[model samples]
Target: MSDASPAPVTAAILVIGDEILSGRTKDKNIGYIAEYLTNSGIDLREVRVVPDVAEEIVAAVNALRTRYTYLFTTGGIGPTHDDITADCVAQAVGVGIDVDPRARAMLLERIKPEDLNEARLRMARIPFGAELIENPISKAPGFMIENVIVMAGVPSIMQAMMDSVAPRLKTGARVTAETIEAGNLPEGGYAEGLAVIAKAHPGVSIGSYPSMTPAGFRNQIVVRGREPEALAAARTEIEALLARLQAERT
Candidate 1:
């Protein structure tokens, strides 16, 4: 084991479901989880939405689980036939999958044992040697196999599971952000200058976001980093660049 704590723990979100890809269901879990991870000092580096296909889910799980420190997957863990996240995760990790008794007991708390049919039993299926993530809203729990965390697609349930799992995760220093509003400044005019500023402050993450405000088009440059000093310096440089652009616009 390393003596020191890791500086930045990065993560990725894998959203699975054909309904999501088809635009039938609006994804609320991704944003919630991303913000949740950010607040917990874990950087959400990437997000990918894949269909419910087993091969695709397995592939995405394997790929992301290796790339980031944690991979949180939402969707396809339900009573329905399409809910195949548990099995897919098992296949990806090369582990045997089966109905976990603990999960069945949790399910029984809400559902009667005699009433537990095939569909309900599907929720009990978990990969070997995986830990359960609590879902207070609904008794059905999600599982964590290695770094990949499987959660319910329903936004509220997913949120609860995330809260339960958050404490157990290895978190790093929270990333701090400073946003500077460049009123009426066109991104095209400041793009090059912004790039230069970004390069100058390699320690901080700098980016320009152009939005259509009621006042018209406005740009905001946001500088994010774990170090307070780095954020201050980047913000100062960005402010200077915006001032110069404003002067030229006049």
Candidate 2:
């Protein structure tokens, strides 16, 4: 038979804001975007949080856009001097930046022509040869310059923009995940065996996560892969290992 399909498409997230680094504003967008991309068959591989500096933004955009299938940038696309992400994106792509008529029309939906001040009009600036990602919640649309998509910092607006662009993006096989719940088990006991299983099944990824909850400490071994059979095999190996260890303790 033909070989199984390749891994899911890859992506990276670039978070830009001074408030985030300063701890003044706790970030709520990264987790949301990570989960969203996971469900959309896009593997979010790298995440970077940079200050609202034009040079930093440009550098990150250049780096991530080249390294991944898609690059998602959140924050710095607002209506203030710190909102310099749009210009940075333009500069990164080596393209002239200007207020696009389409983007201006989107903003006009919320702001009247007379009230469209310069600060608000700044939202309409987009890089040359970029596509607008619609924001249903807010009239200020996000933009996609080639593979690098620039989005708002607000969680609601970023989610809306993602919904709009997801349909148009090229998606790959959805990565499936399996979790084996271990009750208060020490990760040290199974770390070596899990490593062996991981090496045996090169196609799958196995990770052990330990968390503390109100009830007590809990551990979970999560296996992720594209193939169901391979995933099941790895999970079986993990379960058997756990059973043997439990029996030995008893």
Candidate 3:
């Protein structure tokens, strides 16, 4: 292993909505955030799904923002009556929410002055000193306050915001992953040997995924490492172990 320090980046995703908790709507932000963070070389350490309760939202936002290097929140910031993410986040960060001049100008560019009613005006309310995150699909913008970045709940808007914001975030050395598929092997049968192999390589992470096949069952073992040399060495050992185990079974 290299003596270099590990990347200094961590992130967390907060999915907020009563609909998701009630199973009326499936949450999609977690997967998107996880993949995006991984690709950006930020370790996604935690994910939380909370109902649209003011106290819960405030608590979660406070806790996550303080703990992680970056906190991304989705949902509960719309124009509807239930939308309280902005207010909660404002309270969490000890900032006052007001109609931001930049946000109002951005919204006014797309929507007519007559259409800008109280409900629509709510969209312009953001925490003090927050920077706007561009939304290409819709005129409504997301905001970044301190370490926390808030975005839309809709998948398309979230993705667009991520595309715009990714280049600005700090990145670290990316972790590399490799996989080996062992056809028709039972996980229970190979668990002992796999454990031995795992023990031998402390720096590599190995996981076994079992699946059903037309012939019988299959097992896939994935090995991941940050260093190429360590990763290749670990894969060689894992392949040899798998070959020996297969030979024994046959």
Candidate 4:
């Protein structure tokens, strides 16, 4: 028999900002990134929220980039005192960060010379050999190094950068998911039967998501697989099992 390949392409997201940790800002990028990656066949394995400290940012960037197929970082790239993601990333990779000419040219086109002072110049610094990720909402560009994609903290700019980067990412075979709802059925009641069904379809993954209510508990069984045929077959088997379980309950 041939060897089994990896199940899914995986990615990690790092959200860097003092505002997030301080509760001054609620993070909205992780959900957006997770959804975007999942739809493109990239499994989101991990998410991290770190403060604007350089050491923390560097450590997170180093670890995630090494462990995941792709790493996406949002926030900490602005012109403020806390904007340190670029420098931290450079330190993480042992590369010197400097003002990028391409980024400067782009910035110059949009920002006046007087506006390109120290505060604004902070936005142009990029890790050596990194490519720019376009930000349509603002002139400041994000940069990508190896598999790490750095993006703006602002939602609109982050979305635009994602649009620019999504097409170029490598994707494995897409995983298809099917769900069946068992209304008002306690998950424990069907656990054994579901186990049998899961054993029979070992290639497909089955999960029981349960929610509690004032009346009782309900469950939603989700089956996921790379092969559509396998997923469909597993779904049918699960539905049959659910039907049998329901009859037994009533």
Query: Regarding lDDT, does 1 or 3 come out ahead?
Result: 1
Which residue ranges in model 3 land beyond 4 Å of their true spot? Answer: none
Per-residue error for 68 in candidate 4, Å, reads: 1.1
TM-score per prediction, in order, is 0.94, 0.96, 0.94, 0.92
Writing each residue's lDDT as its tens digit, candidate 3 over 120-175 gives 88888999988899887777889988888899999989999998788778888777
Better model by lDDT: candidate 3 vs candidate 4: 4
> Per-residue error at 128 for model 1, in Å?
1.3
Clashes of each: 0, 0, 0, 0
Note the residue pairs that clash in candidate 1.
Answer: none
188-228 per-residue lDDT for model 4 (tens digits): 78889889888988889899998887877778999988878
- Which 10 consecutive positions of candidate 3 have the poorest summed lDDT? 182-191
Ten residues in a row with the worst lDDT in model 2?
1-10
Give the poorly placed runs of model 4, Cα more than 4 Å off: 1-3, 199-202, 211-217
| Superposition error at 65 for model 1 (Å) | 0.7
Candidate 4 Cα deviation (angstroms), residue 120: 0.4
lDDT per residue, candidate 1, 196-221, as tens digits?
98898888998888899787888888
Global lDDT of each candidate: 0.90, 0.91, 0.87, 0.89
